[model samples]
Target: MKKKTKIIISVVAFVVAAIVTTGYIIISGMQKNLDNLKSIESNDVDLSKISDGTYSGSYKVLPISVEVSVTVKDHKITAIDLLKHDNGKGKAAETIINDVIKADSLKVDAVTGATYSSKVILLAIEDALSIATETNNK
Candidate 1:
């Protein structure tokens, strides 16, 4: 082929390859994230031994971070409040609170579209639970 034709074809090929490679990387990264989430096992927490106080917990999912306050009363979780969440326009994930209170644990399914945020929030709650468990043991 001519020099000009060869150069043009090469440029087009490079663009296509770049696009495909970027797509693959994005997909693989997302799958890996989901795998990480799935690997996070739930702990069997006994809240009946905790005191009446608020415990704070936090978890970060890269671009997002969530902080929460867990209030225990008479060894039961009486309330849970989100103190802060650096969500990138994904406010709907806050609904996880209802599930938390209902389950009285952080082992509930994450929201459909907000799975990452949900997992992070639950993990934060788990942090609080861990503290409660540790304190109860002491």
Candidate 2:
């Protein structure tokens, strides 16, 4: 084979390998995130045990992540503010926060077409409330 031809072939092979490796890593990460979502279980917070204040928490699943502050007042969940939300095609999931506040629980149903985002958001909320309860108990 000619030297130039050999160099071209090597370059093409390297490019193909790099692309394949990147694709594999991305796919694996996404699968891991999906698995994490599937395993998610929102913990219930005892509002009565939590002090009246704002608490913050976060949850991340590769491409999706959420950070939220939960407000407690009079032993009730008064509001939830999303500090940060990174989602892909899951912008609609933001509305689920209102539902959660209205329901006063994290057991609310996920938004359509944004289940993973919804789960992460709920998990973050659960963590925030859990922290509040823990701090008040301490």
Candidate 3:
């Protein structure tokens, strides 16, 4: 009976260890992706160079990601739509879109306590605008 109990305990320990190791690996990878996103530099959009149109962009950073569509009209950012935002405890960041539209720039401050989500959202906007510029130049 003691032998059987010990075998069961050993198997349970092994299973637990495997699960823990896998979880740790996934978490670490996610952290790396987050750090990379945090390190990204955002630049202001040059609306003057971009033709009036809607531009779509997306940025992903593990637990957080954002997709945005920006509308430009007469050399101004007229509207912004957040098509998708996958955030963890960063719902407040969604409000940043309004700030962007009001300010007509990505220079607006990030949402407090949701800094990562804020940056991702801004980056997505920048990406969309940048693509517009690229497309125009081509």
TM-score, model 1 to reference: 0.70
* lDDT per residue (tens digit) for residues 1-138 in model 2: 699999999999999999999999998989887887887788777787988899999998988889999999998889999999998888999999999889888889999999899899999999899888778878
Candidate 1 residue-wise lDDT, 30-118, digit = tens = 66766787677656477776777899888875566889999988766778899988875557778988888887777787787787788
Model 3 TM-score (2 dp): 0.92
State how far residue 65 of model 2 sits from its true place (Å).
Answer: 0.8
RMSD list, candidates in order: 4.1, 1.5, 1.4
List per-prediction Cα lDDT, in the order shown.
0.81, 0.90, 0.92
Runs of candidate 3 exceeding 4 Å displacement: none
Model 2 lDDT on a 0 to 1 scale: 0.90
Better of 1 and 3 by lDDT: 3
Please give the clash total of every predicted structure, in order. 0, 0, 0
Total backbone clashes of candidate 1, pairs 3 or more residues apart or in separate chains = 0
Per-candidate TM-scores read: 0.70, 0.92, 0.92
How do the candidates rank by lDDT, highest first? Answer: 3, 2, 1
